[model samples]
Structure formats: structure tokens, C-alpha cells
Target: MIRILLFSGLFTVIITAVQLSLNYQKETEELQTISQQLAETNAPSLARALWELNATKANDIGIYLMRIGLFKSITIKNENGDTMVFLGEKDIEAHQTSIKLQFEYSGRTGTVGTFEYQIVTDIVKRKIKDDFIIILISQFIKTFFVSIFILFIIHKLVIRHLNEISNWLNNFKPESSFSPLALEADKGSSNEMVKLKSAISEMGQQVHKHSTGLEKVVAERTAELEKLAYTDSLTGVTNRGAFLQAANEELNRSRRLSYDVGVMMLDLDHFKAINDTYGHDAGDKVLKQVSQAMANCLRKEDTLGRIGGEEFAVITPGADKRGMHKLASRLQQAIAILNFSFLPDNKNITVSIGYTKVSNDEDFKAALKRADEHLYTAKASGRNTFITDKGFLPRIVS
Candidate 1:
């Protein structure tokens, strides 16, 4: 806007200068014409006076011509080349015009004298200066007003809408909804501002759409990663770390509630012998089946985990010693009934179980260690049976 005003001012100045120059030239020409007319009209009379050698009359004519404000000075000289009259100060730098004084006396023309005048250029210059000032002032005022009007139109139609767009961008959020960009001055016309608003609106919508899709994709990926982190690949059961974490949480709750919780460790009996005889594929099949059977035997409140190779653990919340014994017995029965088609008629799968009640303020690791000790005792006694701190189960015939 400032640049516009500056250029407008410059243009006005150039126009004013050109106009002033032309006016100066025109005024100078008009002054020259007036000077020539005055010389033509007054020369005959001045000549007669000089021919008569009347210095007083010639001086009077010179004073009158000077008073007319055309000539700065006038001089008349007789045919003998003697100055007869002079009026006003002679200006050497002023424009001078010389006229020959001739008189017709009874059809005979003869030179009487010469009339010379200097045109008053100072007065003409002053007039031109006044015109220049007036022209400059008027031009400046016109340029100023025109520039201001243009600026106002631009602000109303363009600048204000641009400010609105800037403010909108500052506040825009891709996750949230916003009103579409609109320009009040647009009047629904497809001008530049309207096109800009439409383009920005479309871009914002695309960003929002992509943002939403990206968020959904990120959430699904996070769920998959979480599952991979906590689930056992072979048995499809809770992995060791996740199971221990869950057990600790349950233990903390049990301690606060003053309730008894049970921890149990179970191992497949002679698991290496089964793997050696049946290959790891069969061993893995047996493990998966045994884990599923144990999970089915347990209540919903219990958590089952594959804590090691051929080793499983269970956490039972709000359980008593009798509840633990019943759960352990169910687990044993479930494993005993499992049938492997590839196994010989004489071959069978079994698990040894050990159970313990969690003591007050005991963490899962301490309780699990005690349960593991019971499991070792059960395994040492024989296989295919369960043991607790209080007692051991009678051996079941396979």
C-alpha cells in the first residue's frame, strides 16, 4: 500500500512537471505576442515624436509603455543616432526587440529613429511560478485522495479476508472440526480470494481424513504389538512375564482384602523322554493339548501361563486350601484323559502339580518359589500326582 502511494505521488510529480513546462512555454509565447502587438501599436507614435526631436514626448510615451507592464525599459534614438528618450532601468539580460521608426510624409517614406524595448520577463516568470505551485498542490491532493481510496478498496476486498485466513490457520486443529473458510466480500463470486478459500478448505479436509486413518492404523498396530508381547507363541497362553505381572497384581489385591490366594506350579512328567521318543513336533502338540486341558479345568478367576519349557503355572485369586486341592485334582484328571493319536497304547502324558496358599504380604515370586519346592517334592516322590505343603496325592495308575 505504501508502495502504491509512493508511485502515485511520483506519477503526479512527473505530470505536474510536464504540465508546468508546457505552460511555461505557452505563457512565454503569449507574452511574446503581446510584446510584439505593443511594439506595433506604439512604434508609429514614438517614431513621430523622435522625428520631431521631441525628447519630452518620447519620454512620456516610454513611461506609458513601461506602466503597461510589458516592457521593462524603452529607448528612442533619432536618425542622427542620438538617444532622444529613455524610461525605466534597462535590463541587459531581458529579451529585447528593436523596431525601425519610419514616417510617410506626403508619399515619401523616411527613417525617423529606432524604438527598442526589453520585455518584462520577471513578471512572466512570477506568473508561471504561481501556476506551478497551484498545479503541484492540486495534483498532490488528487493523488493522495486517489491512493487512499484504492487502499480502502484493497483492505475491504482482499486484506481483511487474508487476515481471516491467517487467524484461521493459527487456530486450526486437524483432529477437530471447523467451519469452512468464507469471505464476506466474496459474494460467492469465483474470484481469487474465493478460489483460495476453497483450496484451503479441501486441503484441511484431506489432512483431517489422513489424520483419522493414521490414528486408527496406529491403534490397531499397538494392539497387535501388545498381544505379541504378552501371549505365548506355542501354547497361545499368557507368557511368563505377563503371568508374573498379573500374579503380583492379584497378590497385592489379596493382601489388601485379607483373602487367601493360591499359586501352583505344574511340570509335564518326563517331558524330555517324551520329546526324545516322539520328536519335538509331538512334544509341542502334547504341550498345547495339556495347557488347553488345564485352562479348561480352572475357573475364570484363575490365570494359566506357560512359564518355561514344558512348565506351567496357575494363579487363583480368593481361593482356600480346599479350593486349591479341588483345582489341582481337576487339572490332574483333565491331563490324564488327554489322548494323543500318535502315542502307542502303552504310552501316556502326565503332569506333576504343587500348590501353596499365599502368605500375608507375600509377593508372587516368594509364593511361586514355595510352590516350585512342592512341585520338586511331588516330582521326587513319583510322577502323575500333585503335592501341597500339608499333604501329597496318592499315585494314580496310568
Candidate 2:
């Protein structure tokens, strides 16, 4: 954008310069014509006045020219190499566009003193500046609309299709076969970016012979998928990889529909301490109990994933700020009072949760980071709590 803006600025400047030069020359020519016409009309009186050395008549002519406001200065000089009368300031502006002309008249049988009138610009520079400004504004308006039009075309011809492909990639499931991706029949633009997207979409959809054993192909495909399925062996919930994939796909969809999503990260407080004191088996039981407790609090559409060890992440689609608070509170309460009487000393576990609402345009990782930040905030303000814009609180609901 910066580069485009700079280029636009330079273009406007260049065009403004050209427009200014054209206007200046045009106005200068017109001014010269007007000056010559004025000098011709005043010729007879001024020549008679200078021949009789009538300062009054000569001064009157000078005053007439001055009153016209075209010339900055006026002076009448005699032909005897002498100054007859100087009536106005002799100083002229630097690089001023002006014209000087001499008017002579034959009085009887002799040449009279000359009338040297100087005409300076009354509108050339101003008109040049005005032309430059008009051209600049015109260029700006054209550039703005053209830029918007180009962006719209790119979005329709390439960006929308590319986003569609990206969403498919995010939702790719090895266990399922997707129909071939094809572009609609529109030959409006043939850009390389669009072509590359078409190439990527065509990768796995190549037509091949189906003459092999049908059952054998199905069996081999299932086996291959079994190896790639994203599932946690221990908790039986989503593993980290599966969580990211599903969440990313959900995010892409939410963005397209302009809806909000929410994510939460929780750390079982003193999880390592539990393992150190009661052993790995007891820690395993705790993880399972907490996982179940969280699951019980969530809707069917919400996702539960064990990030690793005692850290877990959750993604809830279509959850706004109010929903985010209610959901986070329910999970918090569930985990806080979890019953583990079977463990020694009737041990209970508390979780510190960090959460944030996700917008469609944001990355899942960014939402995760915010959730983790709130998680840290919860942990920092004393464990067994959740952080919101309202600060850390133990129970958000009555």
C-alpha cells in the first residue's frame, strides 16, 4: 500500500507539473494579446502627451495602466536618453511572466518620445496553480476508484476461490474423499495467482484407473487413514493435532459467516506436584476426571482437546462475549469442586483458565495466545480462578 501511495503521489506531481506548464503558457499568450490591444488604444494620446512634454497627460496614461492592475510598474522615458517620469515601483517579481512593448507616434513631421508600458501577470500564475490543483484532485479521484475496482476484481476472480481452497485444506480429512475442486466457468481474468490455486486444487483429483480390487483398495485406504486419524489414545478426546485442524477449520468457516468463536486454555494447578506425591497413576486418574468434568459442561459442538499432559485447550463456535463468560465459568466451577475422594486425603483439583473470544479474521494461534495469557493471569492472581476484562474472579455466576 505504501508503495502504491508513493507511486500515486509521484504520478500526481508529474501530471500537475505538466498541467501547470500548459496553463502558464496559455495564460501568458492571452495576457500578451490583451496588453498589445491596450497599448494600441492608448497610442495617440500618449504619443501627443510625450511630444509636448505634458507630465500631466503622461502621468494620466501611467495612472490608467496602473489602475488596470495588470502591470506592477509604469515609466515614461523621452527619446533624448532621459527619464521623463517614473510613476510606479520599478521592482518586478522574480521569474515573473510579463511583457514590455514600445508605442511610438508621428507628430506632424517628427517622432515623439516613446510610451514604454510594462504588463505583468494578473492571472497566469494563479491559473497555473489552479490547474495543478484541479489535475491533482482529478488524479486522486481516478486513482481511488480504480484501486477499489481492481481490489474487487481480484477478490472475485482469485481471492474468494483461494480462501475456499484454504478452508478445504484446513478441513482436510484423510478418512474422507473430497470431490474435485473446480473453478466456475468465468474467463474474466487469467492471472498467475488464480492459475496456481487451480493447480493446487487439481492435485489429488487426477483421474486414474479403477480396475484394482475394490475391497482391497478400501481396506488399504482405511488402514492408511487409521495411521493418520487425529485422536488421543489416553483421554479419548481430540489430540493436539486434531484440535488445531478442527479449530482452524471452524475459524475459517466462522470468518466467512462473520461470527465469533471462543477458546480457553487451562492448566491443572500443581499437576506435577500431584504426580510427585501420589505417582503417575494417580495423576492419570486426575486428568481423566477433569477431562470428563469439562466435557460434561460443554455443548455438543464445542471441542475438547488435551493439549499435552495437564494442559488442555477448548474451542467453542458461535460464542460471543456473554457466552464465553458463561462457558468459562461453568467449566471453572466444575473443575474446582471435582470429587476425587478415591484419592488419598480426598484430594480435589482446581484449574486456572485463560480465555478469549475469537473473531473470524484472527488466527487460532492468536486466540490460543490470548487464552494462555489469561491463563497466566489467572495463575498469577492466585490459582483457581479465571481472568476477564473485569479482572480475575473465582466464580462469575451466582
State model 2's lDDT. 0.75
**Evaluated with lDDT, which candidate comes out highest?**
1
Name the top TM-score candidate: 1
Clash number for candidate 2: 1
lDDT of 1 by residue, 183-255 (tens): 4554533388877877887887788888888889999999888988998999989999999999988888888
Please list the C-alpha lDDT of all candidates, in the order they appear.
0.84, 0.75
Relative to the unseen true structure, what is the C-alpha lDDT of residue 139 in candidate 2, on a scale of 0 to 100? 86
For 1-398, candidate 2 gives per-residue lDDT tens digits of: 45766687788788779868877887777776787677667767766777777879878887887788776666666766466766666655523322222344453345455555556764677767777788888888888778678778877777777787787677654445656555564677556656666676666343222323455698898976764577677677788999999999889888888878889998999899989987988888888888889999999999999899899999988876678777777888898787765555556788898888775567789879888988999999999887754442334345
* Native RMSD of candidate 1 (Å): 6.4
